[model samples]
Target: MAISFDRAADFYDQTRALPPEVADQVTECILRLSRATPETTFFEPGIGTGRIALPLVERGYAYTGVDISEQMMDKLRQKLVGKPHQLTLINADITTLPLESGVFDVAIAAHILHLVADWRSALAEIQRVLKPQGVLIYFHHPGSGATRNDPIDQQWRTILERYSYQADFVGAVTEDVLGYFQAQNLAIETVSVAELPRIRTAAEALQTYCDRIYSNLWQIPEPIFTPAIEDLKTWVQQTYPDLNERFESSYEVTVTAASRAR
Candidate 1:
């Protein structure tokens, strides 16, 4: 079974929010890459809280989202109050979609593949539901090479390593994902979307870890987790003597699009 974001629903948007302009840019990027129009039907697996789906749904495109978490989908529903939109929400797993074959024009997978235990099955399911020539747009943050320079993020990773805590991602790795596309002979088109500036104090970063807002941190055993967090706190205090001093960083959003052959 894939991990579910049911517990993270309350704070998911607060921690993962993109600036309004950046959100618009992402929606526009998907629309342009998928060659979408008003009549295009969009399907998103693991569509927690509709962070990506809302913009398109609000624009009158037909959208269907599936997730294992009812709580996360509820948050999306809360946002849809009184809004005129063509939207359908299903509580289901992505690996075995309950949808009919060849029903959608575009499918979106955003930061979801690595969390699923059977990502290959999920990929096949996405292709099965798409109309011939329909597009799948995969969205993710830039790879480790891009984030290794961020001290706060680096320190947190170090603490986890010191505790010998390995992340529990059961799905396909980056190379495997690209390889799957290649094996299927699906030509991929890649794009880097507009970067969003991020500013946060070292103390704030530590607090976020303490709150366990990230899914990767959720499964850490309590015995290891407590000490790991303490180690991170000590590092932050030493690295930023002034805990309130803000550090600047930017988030890079990347999109890879591939279409099923007719």
Candidate 2:
């Protein structure tokens, strides 16, 4: 099943706002890939809240955004007021979008591939819809490779890999991503990196942030997860409250852009 973000849509935007450093990287890559122009027809699959689409539209680019979440689309719809550019919003799956072949100049999928059951299919869809030699810009947060050291973290990774390897966030490592594009004969044009998209100064702060943000997982009725959240929080507060203010975590991200073979 595709991961659902209906209830988390508002909270996700509230916690993370536009003009954030990370967002700048994502948007900058898109612009570079599109070689931004007035006639550029851009498509953003999983365009949450129009974060990137709205800005592109405002900048005079025509855009079409598609997402599976009605709630997210509703939020994006509310934010569409006063934008005087040609923008079309669709509620559909990226893997099975109803778009004409070779229609878009550039396609973007940001921080969303990991949530799909078959990311390759989405890539195929982008290939099918983008014009020959068109660009595809994608971003991923490879959660698996990030938290592999800790036992609990490693265990979580194992479970996810076992159950959702095909769709697991970061299903493709850097090499895997590069190989996939190369095999398709798509040229890798640019690579940009950003570490720790959201930074916490100390372990305690990280714990607190994780606690508040992941309350749902912690509050689950299941015995395993129920105690894990609170225990982690208490451990952080008691053992490394000072570290919470002194430590930092950088979430490394890579933005890859490739051109479909002509």
Candidate 3:
């Protein structure tokens, strides 16, 4: 079930009640890595709902963003009304971008690198449009690398490790990202890596698993998803007896910035 971020926009907007500062942090990372002078052009692939772009343009950076989902772009367009900054939003996949080469000064991919079929080709496409020394930053959040620290979370990890199926994309991490960027001849550098907070209940966390909230889980057959939940719940209750507690939700974000080789 390949998801168009447009179709997932409402679910995304509804489920996401992010900490206000998190958005600011994304903008700050871009500013720190890319020297955003007034004339410096910027591009974002899969810029769903302008999470980073909206705040970025407010600070006076020129913007060009591409996404496959028109519905998602439509939502982002509504927010750009009367804004005094340059924005060019195109409905296209980042892999086969219909843009000029060497025009952009910076390009950022937030939670998007892992979604592409051939991320190497996507990196090539991104590099095609970047000017010399252009900065490219990728934001990845490998949700809660939670191990045995919490019994219930450990169970969730256990079930996912056993059952979750992602057909094409898999295991996005900082090491793979750096290696890929280096293979593409981009100069890699670290930006900011931190764990960010969110809030969810024990039930909600389990629901995420059951409902296949994570895109990779969608590849798992419906029959398996439910049973995996049932198995996770039953075992947690029987094995970890007093382990139904809820905790503040959090995930780690690894931001790696790469420079286009001249």
Candidate 4:
């Protein structure tokens, strides 16, 4: 079973919400890449909190979102109140969709494939539900170029490994995902949607790790996580005497649009 975001529903938006301008740009990019119009139907598996679906829904597009977390879907429902949208939310697993075949014009997989234990099955289901030549838009944050060199993130990874914390991702990485598309003979196009500026203090970065905002951190056993976090904190203090000092970076959003050859 894939991990559910029920525990994070309340704070998910606060932590993961994109800036309004960036969100609009993402929606536009999806539209341009998929060549979708109001008549195109959209399907999103693991559409937790509607971060990617809401903008399209607001534009009068027909959309359906599926997820195992009712709490997360409820957050999306709350936002739909007093808003006109042709949207449907289903509580279900992505590996086996309830919808009929060849029904949707576009499908979205954003930061979600990594969570599914049987991601191949999920992708098969997505392909099954899409109309012939329908597009699949994959979205991910590759992090700014600086992320690889960021001492804070590097330390966090080191501490995590020292505690025997392993990532629980059962799906393919970016390269594997593209390989899957190639195996299926789907035409693929990649684009950089936007690069937004971000700034945060070292203390704030530490707090985010402590809060386990990232999904990969959710699986760490309490005992292991506690010690690992303490190690991270000590490293942060030793590396930077002033925890309040802020660092600037950028957040890059990339999209890979794959379509079955017509």
How many pairs of residues collide in each model? 0, 7, 0, 0
Location of the lowest summed lDDT over 10 successive residues in candidate 3: 141-150
The regions of model 3 sitting more than 4 angstroms off are 141-154, 160-172, 235-244
State the lDDT of candidate 3 residue by residue for 63-91, as single tens digits.
99999888888888888787777888998
The number of residue pairs in model 3 that clash at the backbone is 0
Between candidates 3 and 4, name the one with more favorable lDDT: 4
RMSD for each model, in Å, please?
1.7, 4.4, 3.3, 2.1
Worst 10 residues of 2 by lDDT: 214-223
| Candidate-wise lDDT, in order | 0.86, 0.66, 0.71, 0.86
Worst 10 residues of 1 by lDDT: 140-149
Query: Residue-wise lDDT of candidate 4 within 96-167, one digit each (tens)?
Result: 999999999999999888777788899999999999889999876343223334668777777776766664
Q: What residue pairs clash in candidate 4, if any at all?
A: none
Q: What TM-score would every model get versus the actual structure?
A: 0.95, 0.79, 0.83, 0.94
* Top-TM-score structure, candidate number: 1
Clashing pairs in 2: 196-250, 196-251, 201-247, 202-243, 202-244, 203-244, 204-244
Model 1 segments more than 4 A misplaced = 141-148
Cα RMSD of predicted structure 4: 2.1
User: Model 4 — TM-score against the truth?
Assistant: 0.94
Model 2 over residues 1-262: C-alpha lDDT tens digits?
Answer: 5655576676767655644676677676678766877788898888878776766777778888888888877887787676576878888888898988999888887767766657788878988888886888876545444632333344433433444332224334455566778888777765755554344454634444355453224223345444544555555566555763554334555677889555
| Candidate 4, poorest ten consecutive residues by summed lDDT | 140-149
